[model samples]
Target: MGSRFVNLLARSCNGGPRHFSLHRMNPANLFHPTRSAVPAVQPLADAPLPPPALSFGWPGKKGELAWMNFMAFGRTGNNFLAVDQIGRTFFYDTDSRSLRTGMPMMCKPIMDPISIAVGDSLYVMSGNPGPSPGKHCFQALIHGRLPASDTNDWSWYSLQPPPPFVNDIPRFHEDEVKSSCGDVPAPYEIGAYTVVGESQIWVSTAGAGTYSYDTVSGAWSKVGNWSLPFRGRAEYIPEHNLWFGFTPNNLQLCTSDLTASSEVRPPVLQNMWTDVVRPKNWTLRDASLVPLGSGKVCIARFFVTHSDNFEDMSAYKKRENFAVLEGVEVLKAGWAHLRMVKHKSERYVFGRDLVIPL
Candidate 1:
């Protein structure tokens, strides 16, 4: 059976080695059909919690000089890439928690970029060449698998510039430059990207509009206005054919249709939000919502809080909580059916970069 992994980056509070861990989960075991039929806030620590399959050092440091700034990340099958502050990208085998040999990306790294894996390929958009000469609004596709041994290598090839709708947005002045290929428009800073079915990738920029790229024909089109509270961070729940967005205080839903509406139906960008049950005395840092095998959803949240509210931010401690919600229709989620199933204490000062297999 296929498994899903949650990847997180963190470090010890006492200034120890930074650690990256991948928690493995088999969605089939995440829920029970015969549990309480009504909605109620239950303690997650009472249920069985899945453990980490792989944990290791965070890439980027060689000596005593590493600063550990998270740059970007993407996953292709069991392999995941972690980009460091200096623009170096390292690949790891999630099954073994081992690093694979490979050269870093050809361009300099910036901030949040649209990164995703489709089949055997990893596609990265924007966040390259670090906006010096110009904002590099380009896309690159890394093909092939990890080298058979330490001596072989994979290939990174740049794709054509994103379509007009992407480059045409007024976020930045369009720069026309020639790469090794030919004349192309610079890449725009992409806030998030997600796969839409089998043939398209949906992108939300740092501001305003949302766009989609056709994988088969290599074309781009404006999909909808990005007015939702959360942009790229929203996760798709296939069972309901809807997108789920999260905040510390609420959970929101919207149609997964990637098209702007004209006359027939309302636009999917308009979202309906609902309050969720959170543990007392916990402040959320990051969270992820992934589909559990049979019409169930697992919501994983990273939280932090201080022994005393008057203390400095550095005094806060971190923990993770997991909850399961089942059988509630998305449109009619007036009262949540969520329950806490697991909890883990994190020794790190903090955590970020919640990556789950798509």
Candidate 2:
């Protein structure tokens, strides 16, 4: 067993009085299904609420955990897949609250790779390969699958790279390129990706364009000249028949009808919500939306707390890191209006570990 998993088990066993109702309980408490040692003679009506399920850390030193890319996998969405810059893979099962090492990636090491989960399989796309003089461009596409029962049988296989035109988009003027010796333009990186329905994986580039990859035919096709309105991974909400994701610049929670987008037009954002009121000094580092079935979603935001000191900004004692987890329920208010009810919010002091939903 991984050390991280052991630590989680220990913490769970030592937890104080907790409610039996799963709805009000912390999701992390569900990790370990072990019953309490001493049964309560009578329910403590005023028992303190348990800590958020976001306390555990990843398997790495401080700062190293930020380099890894994470995605929720498996049929129950209880397993999380994490891959680092050096091709190392880790599988974490929330049901068992255990971490297991998986096979290394077949492609070269990618920094902040784009990943998406479709059914039981996971697909990874382009990223910065390395920092060498000529190897600084974004490239590579591959995927891996979970074994039916044997964990050791898990592995990855290479897939065809995106079309060459994706990299031909000019980043600088011809005259400027001709004047400079080492000012080569880097290839376009993935801006966002989501699985459409069941067989199609839609990808949007930074400014190049949008494209679709057919998982069944193993073929790629151009979607349109415009890019997806949101960034990173978007989750499909079956109840609303729309995809929910964060807007590119402001990190606002937004939803769009991807089915309406086509080669003739771009995706349209139907609704947006300012779910969190953040401070000016706090820098938003990352955000993810995890759908918890039945029109409910969890939003996780990681922030870097900046110091008031302007001079000597690099001082070690000037900064702190933390994360906020908020729950929201989306409902239909009328024929055309959608209502979002914000629930309780939990804050935790962030560290090297990445708080991705299992």
Strongest candidate by TM-score: 2
lDDT of 1 by residue, 1-358 (tens): 1125433444433355566555554443434444443335433333343455545565555474443333223432445666665666666666576776465563655344556555456666653232332334444545545556554355555455534444344444435443222323334444445676666777654443566777667787766665333534565555445556553134343334434343333335444434355547555545555544334455555555434555655444343333332222233344333223332212222233233322
lDDT of 1: 0.47
Q: Model-by-model lDDT, in order?
A: 0.47, 0.58
User: Compared to the true structure, candidate 1 yields what TM-score?
Assistant: 0.63
TM-scores, one per candidate: 0.63, 0.70
Name the runs in model 2 displaced over 4 angstroms.
1-69, 84-86, 102-105, 128-152, 161-168, 171-187, 312-316, 351-358
Q: Candidate 2, residues 28-50: lDDT per residue as tens digits?
A: 32121222332323221222434
- How many residue pairs collide in each prediction? 7, 0
